[model samples]
Target chain A: MKKFLWYFSVTLLAIIFMFPFVWMLLTALKEPGTALVLSLPKKLTLYNFKKVLFEFGFSRFFLNSLIVALSSATVSTLFASLAAFAFAKKSFFMKEYLFWLFIASMMVPGLLYVIPQFLIVYKLGWINTYWGMIVPHLANVFGLFLITQFMRQVPDSLLESARIDGASEFKIWWRIMVPLAFPIVATVFLLNFQFHWSNFLWQLIVAQSEEMYTVPVGLAMFKSAHEEAYTLEMAASSVSIVPISLLFIFAQRYFIEGITQGAVKG
Target chain B: MKKGVRDNINAYSFILPFAFIYMVFLFLPFIYSIYLSFNQVTDFSDVFGGLSFVGLKNYLFLFRDKEFWWALVVTLYYALIIIPLNIVVSLLLAILLRKRYRLNSMYRTFFFLPFVLDAFVVGIVWTFIYAGRYGLLVNILKPLIGGIYETGFLGNAKTVMPSVALAMTLKGAGFGMILYIAALDGIPKEVYEAAELDGATGLKKLWYITLPLIQPVTTFMVIIGIIGALSAFAEFYAMTGGGPIVYKWGTPLGMTKVTGLYLFNHFSNLRLGLAAATSFVLLVLALGLSITYSKIQRKR
Candidate 1:
């Protein structure tokens, strides 16, 4: 009886939670209309998707987002791991001070970096370029900080053995620490990818060219430009939803682990 | 202790790539933003040599600016509601799902799906749901409210802030839910079992035991919630475009212009110095809130 009650409440809540996505799906399948009502399409079709994908060039935006998010996540996670290895395992001069300095940077709201970041990219004439999207955000203080905490848990005896066996410091980091800390690295990578993937404000500010737009920026622009074409806009948002939703479904463990670990340890 | 400067140098080499990039992109720009905030620049074309410094005028202007003050109050009113409501809702949901029930993972995923989504998507979809005329809320729930259909909250002067705040709260509650679930999982079964033996059950156990035990996670969530609330931009942009109808709303506040959106508008208008000052003010508030709450969180 208690189990039934539990299931009832949870399932009810879940329906409320999942309703928007379902509505989006339903909206995407229906024909464009003057008024959007919540109901199953009388005749379902892929016309909205076809229109959004082909005419509005959301496919290009998707690819742009993929390239930026994928490369940015990889590079930032690698950099963070490399620095994390140093902080976690090495006895470098001013290591504590430097690590704290990085952590302190995390407290600075990302908005603070926007103006100067834009200016620097503009100065270098990198605006509306891939470098403008990717390079400026590679210094992820949170990623470095999170991975450092994870790396500190790696047993020193293993590092000692690797060092004794004539492994160079770089080799040890490349071979040992990276492999052992791969879980946290993956977690950080996924987190970073999500940030870049859904990033809007910076891309909106810097990417004057439509060719450089990421998915969120494209979706936002699509919303305004096609305000009356609600079905087409729904299709654009639905396209944005699929990748992240799949990422959440498959890799939710790592994502939630990273967040909870932040609460407990970081 | 085995000590060679050589060993340290070798370790430092691993950190060099990150340090160089961090310095140029993040650290340098941060200092430059402070410099830019002191100047009035008409054009961002010559970022270096084109600006004449206006000293504290930007700061002073913002202090005297009614619209800026309105944004701050709306942000606070937005934050004050979102922080507490989200913390409660997510906590209640997490605690309710503490047991290893069937389909709990499915429930967890459904609840947390919003956190993973772009706020743009959430805002857009929810805007559709609250579309006043054709919205699900009106079509489905109108009878519940005696069929009184208006612009709903999205287009109202009095209710737009809370209306957007509600959507944001729902989207964010999932994040805190996941954190709370993790904290709940770490609490051993024996403690709860003992409480049960002592005749504490249901609400008694929750109030006396669960809340106190999960205090750290609660604190962490609260601090994060505050920062998230203050920095909210994309949602307001997507949903309200920063206003529906502007009024003083009884608190010297307009409806929905948040600090992030205000700063964003300034940036778009090429008011670079004022934008920088806004960023500075936002940054200081964020840091202050995080530090204050985290300090209190650690105290217990």
Candidate 2:
């Protein structure tokens, strides 16, 4: 009886969790007015998805999102890791001050800075460009803080042994620390990808042309179109949702571990 | 001294990229925003002009702006409503899933799917669900609530904010559940075992033991909840585009145009100075709230 109840609740929760995606799929398959009912379609078709991807240029937007997410993750991780190393290993004047400043910046509501950041992007003539999105985000305080905490856990003896073998600091970091920190690197990459991929306001502010629009901004614009085109909008929504959900499926362990670590060390 | 200087140089090189970008982008922009808040400029082109300085006028204007105050009230209302709603529902769900259960990981992944979703995507999906006419909700309510047939949840002034809040609350509660589940796992089993020895079970054990233990995690969730509610932009932008008009249930976004959305609009139109001023206002509000909340937490 207990087992049966458990299974029932599990199935129910899963259904509830997947209701929207199922709705999106059903909506996409339907001829417009048919979707107005919650019932399943008697027919299935791929027209809405095709129209969104081919006719509406969703493919370009997806590619743009992929490029931005990948580039931001790679560049920001590299810079953040290097900064994290400095904070973890070195004792210098204002080191504590700098670290604290960065930590404080993490808590600063991002909305407050969105406008200022846009202004900076404008002044640099980077509006509607890749560099505008990528540059400001390169200094990720959370990434820096997380990496620094993880790097501090590395045994100093390992680094000393490498030094005794005449390894340079860079070499030590590249060879020893980098491999040991793979879990964190993966976490940071996934988190950053999740953040940058779903970033809307930034993309909305900086990306002028439809060609440059990322998925979130693209989805926003798509939803804002004439109200009657709900089928196509749902199709576009599913396209964005599927990839990120797949990403989480693959990286759920790391994402959970990262948040747990943040709480423990925080 | 020379050797120390060499180490300093190496450190500087290590920190250079972060420092340079932060100073140029974040720090400088922050200062410039404060300056812009004091000056008046009509457009982006006029930003560099020698415009007359108007001290505290923008802020004063914001104070008198009924829409801004309404936005503030609505925002607080939304935060107050959603925070407890998420905490209670997530905590209960976390407890339900905490025991030995088949398909546990599967259930977790499914529940957490929404947090990973783009808010814009969720907005699109929920818009369909909440559509005024021919929407799933309307279809369901047509037979039951006759008057509700014509009234879309988001389309109606009375229901718009609450309906949006409900959607967000549903989407967000899942994430809080994940966090609480993680926290719940750390709670030592002995505490429960001890409670059982005293013949406490169910609600009694939960209130006396479990709630106290998870207080820290609950605090963290509350802070993040407030920030999340206040910083909410994508869903509102995607769903309502601010609003049809500020209703009784209107959000800050509906009433005064949230700073984030306003920033996007103003900057897109090339009104950079006013955008900057608006940013400063947002910054002050956020800072003030954070400090107030931190103080409240510290006292607790």
Candidate 3:
């Protein structure tokens, strides 16, 4: 009886957590007029999704988000690993001070950088461009810290052996350190990807043109502009969530590991 | 000696890419923001042109700005509510799911699922759930609880902040749960076994053994939660737009406008100087909390 009660409560909690997403999907599938009603749709249809994708030009936004997130994550991770390798295995002047400087920067509220970064991006004539969206965010201090923490645990003997083999520093990082630190590297990449994918404020500020709008920006605009279009809003929200949700489900281990590792150790 | 020099050269080469970007984008902008805070930029479009120095004017203006104080209060209230609520919910979930069960992993996945979502998307879905007439909550409760929820949770001044905080708490609890689960896993089994042997069972065991063991995680969560609450923006932007405007002392304040949103509002209005000042205030608050956290960690 006790075990049954436990299962029951857990299941109830699960239902509570899952309800909003379920409702969103259901409303998206419903006809426009029926979206507000809670009952099952009388005739489920793909009308809302189709409209959002084509008529609202969400496909373009979706593509923009993908390109931005992918490039940002890849470049951010690559640079972070290079710096992490230096911080972890190599001896450099002021290495400790530099690493601490990076760590301290993380504590400063991100809002402080917004006005200045925007001006800098504008000065570079990157407004309404992917460069504006991606460049400012590439120097990810948190990613650097995370990768540095992981790479520090990497055995130094392996690097010494690679050095003895006359491997160049770049080749050593690419061939040895990367493969060995692949899990954490992948974790940093995935975290960065997720961050850029849903990053709204920066994208909103930079992507002034409709074509450059990412998923979150487009959805926010869509919701506000079409306030009465409940079905369409639901569809757009669904589009914004589905890709990340699918990715999370498939690679949940990395997501969980990355989050916990960062919090616990840092 | 030459090898040492060569090693230093290689290290600097490796660090140069990130350091260059960091210097130009992050470090430089950070310094520039301070400079911007002291000067009034005449044009939003051309921040570099027509800049007039107005030392401490922005900061002084914010000192008397009731709207800014209200945002700080809302942010503090949000932090107070969300930190405790999230810790309780997440700690409970972690404790409950700690023991191996038939569907434990599935239950964990279900709870953690929401954390993976964008706050904007979650906020939008929640707005519908809290919609006035035909919202799921209203429709479900109208017959039982009656018209109180008619304006919906996000539609009222009294309830709007807590309502948004609740949505955020649900979205965030999974993260805390993950942390707690890891912390709980680290607690040696012998401690629990010894407690059981001493006739401490059930809640007694939990209060005495489990709670103390997870205090570090609690502290971590509290600090992180406080920082997260202070910097909260996307949810307010998406759900309320810091709305259901309430008037106090003849001033209109957004009921949900925390410091992050307040900063964004200033920036949007092209009040660049004020925005930078607001950010500095937020930075001090965040840094203070982080310092307190580190102090606590060191004490242990």
Whose DockQ is greatest here?
3
iRMS of each prediction: 1.3, 2.0, 1.0
Of 1 and 3, the candidate ahead on lDDT is: 3
lDDT of 3 by residue, B145-188 (tens): 55546788788787787788788878878999999999999999
Give the chain A TM-score for each candidate: 0.97, 0.95, 0.98
lDDT of 3 at B279: 88
Task: Give model 1's TM-score versus the native structure.
Answer: 0.95
- Model 3 bad stretches (over 4 Å): B144-149, B293-300
**Model 1 clashes, total count:** 0
DockQ of 2: 0.65
The stretch of ten residues in a row with the least summed lDDT in candidate 1 chain A is: A31-40
Ranking by lDDT: 3, 1, 2
User: Over the stretch B1-300, how does candidate 1's per-residue lDDT look in tens digits?
Assistant: 356777787778889889988998989989999998999995556766789989999999999888888888888888888888888989978987887887888888889888888898889988888777677776777766442356755877666777787888778789889888888888899999999999997899889988889888777777776777677889989899877755464444447878888898898888889999989988888878888888977786
Docking quality level of the chain pair in candidate 3: high
How good is chain A of candidate 3, measured by TM-score?
Answer: 0.98
In the range A1-266, model 2's lDDT, one tens digit per residue, is: 97788778777866876787888888888876576666788788888889989888899999999999989988888888888888988777789999998787777677657666876787789988999977888888888889999899999999999999999888987898878888997898888888899888788878999999987787777766756787788888888888988889988998877777777566
Residue pairs clashing in model 1 are none
Residue range B1-300, candidate 2, lDDT tens digits: 998888888887888888888887767766767777777765446455645688888778766765656656667776777788889878867876886676788888877778778887898798889876688888877777555567677766667777777777667777778778878898898889988999998899889898888887787887787677667788878777666564453433364244445555655675555556666666667667766876787787
Ranking by TM-score: 3, 1, 2
